[model samples]
Target: MTRRPSPPQSTLPSDPILALRANELLARGRQLESQGKIADAARVSAELVNVAPDLAEAHQFMGSMAMRTGAADIAAMSFERALQLKPRSADLHIALAQALLALQRPADAARILDKGRTLHPNDAGIFRELGQAQLDLGQPDAALKSFSRATKLVPNDLYSRHMASALATTGAPNPGYVAELFDSYAGTFDAHLTGKLEYRVPQALAAALAEHGPVAGPTLDVGCGTGLVATTLPETLRPIDGIDISEKMIAKAQERGVYRHLRTGDAHAVLADEPDFAGPYGLIVAADVFIYIGDIGDLFASLAARLAPGGILAFSIEFNEAQGIAIRSSGRFSHSPAYIHGLAAANDLSILAEVSHPIRLEREIPIPGRLFLLRRG
Candidate 1:
């Protein structure tokens, strides 16, 4: 009895025409979005949702459109409906959690992501999202575990590795880690740093520079995140040039219309090798730049080479009281006063002025730091 294995079963909807219609609408909406007709794509998504209220894909499409349009509330509702229709779908769970996170409900997002992880134990994205949710909830230990798991799953993911490193409270973050961090953060950086963290490094550094009389030639802004230093400096220090690791951050800095030139690169390598950035410049400012940079010995040597005679090199550091660098749990590295003084002397740079101040706030607590103005002999 060669019982032909019963004909392969179909998973298509009972109403094939309706399923076809829904798929066609989804494609059209995606096409519209791809063509940059965002409003039209949104309207198509809305129509799809109405035509196929029971279709999980239709609701997901609507939710994605809402999210793209910054309608997090609408996105949340649509994703919830999608999740209801596809309870076991890992993508649906992630979508709902993202919507919840955007709504500032990290606890809720964490709950959803935890459930998603339970169901799909091997999903790296779920672990990554869960880590972010846990971090938002101030669960660093839990976030560390999640990020570690994600790193284990996707081994080469820089963001996961960096988050793990930050949580482990050790190791100098790699350049890739710093670039990825600021690129993703560039959008909200200015507001968050200035408003929430009460960052005043640029202002303080500018004040210090003003004391040195007038700076001559073009000034260089190192690790110039969003051109804050360029904007804060006096007009006398015009024709400013800036370099940063993150392209997105560089774009933001460019939008400020302050710098004569802006470059996206590791300041260490750029200053050492790039001819355009190489300058026997009058002033080089690195406001709050040393946090991401663990070792400045090489950087100091580079700065010494670039500085014109009597050129000023001004910078700030998260002040570590210990006699060496400390990798803080915040993923930032702090340097001791002794270390900076030693480095400056070794690099033939004389300390002009040193000011200890509260650079910014972390968790509403002021973080102590030091600003140093060094002069090339």
Candidate 2:
């Protein structure tokens, strides 16, 4: 998480003695930070309040240090104090917005970002953060507008452009956007998905794959977040390879120690670009990954070329009534059953089994999707 710029000594208390001391202490803190003495810097920042209680920069430094050390609650409190001292500071508002997001107060973060917009109407960074907050709150329409505003304000920033384009139409998702989105969710992903959301795609996929038989040999786990699917894999399938766009998710997956190799990139490209891959892959599994992928024709082509004869490709997809694929208002894609079956046949793959189930809970309501097992013919 990046913090906004700190105010200079000129923005501190008017008393010459207090301002000089605050500046001196701020310089020492910087030197300590440069030397990797983070705790010392934090201690110095804490002492600044005693000398210059009215200095917003001191509280800003304290907030930055707290955020650095993962004390989001403390960071929020410090940032709130800084904001109170400098109510109209755009930078302080942005800092507080980020802290609120870390604390799972996205609605509050959205409101603060709105405040920031009023202060810095032309600042693209404010719009970007506002878009993220809106998206996190499940208001994609609002997020789309905010992201569009960011792209308009910062035309040179490709990231904002990509996000706007991705949301503009139903097409292939922007890998960069999806990666960053999941990276932000990585810390709380497992708990939120399994605990309150009731994510059971992995368990269901494993059950279907086992019942289908020949569950043997190497496996490729696409979007294998935290290796939840790998836990149920047969021991014979040693050295599973997992591919995900998020580096943080890969880090969490590595903790499971079940994967032989894990890489960060688009799953389709990661699997397609494996030059050393000799024999056909025995099994390839994707649990709730395709939702981020709108059209699967390209992925099917890659799988048709690499999947072993009689080897199975198992995955889950959100259900949709659209004629083909549709990106939900929440920014997730859903595939029509007719679309999946049609694509499978066109790609020389035979559907082994397709089961309808509630994939997960969205706002505590069941989200229905289908799990399919496809075999290369």
Which model scores highest in TM-score? 1
In candidate 1, position 36 carries an lDDT of 79
Worst 10 residues of 2 by lDDT: 271-280
- In order, candidate lDDTs are 0.84, 0.81
The TM-scores of all predictions, comma-separated, are 0.62, 0.61
* lDDT (Cα, 0-100) at 133 in candidate 1: 84
Report the C-alpha lDDT of model 2 over 1-377, residue by residue, as the tens digit. 89997643326667898889999998998889889788888899889877777778888888988877667888899888888878888888889988888777889999999988998999898898887788678786887898889889887665565556666765556656677778989999999899878998898998898788776767888788889999988897766888888999999999999988888887667766766333367888889988877777887677666778887889999997764876553456789999998988888889999999888876346888999999986
**Cα error, candidate 1, residue 19 (Å):** 4.2
Q: Compute the lDDT of residue 357 as modeled in candidate 1.
A: 83
RMSD values, in order shown: 8.5, 8.2
lDDT of 2 at 357: 83
lDDT of 1 by residue, 23-63 (tens): 89989999998997878999999988776778788888889
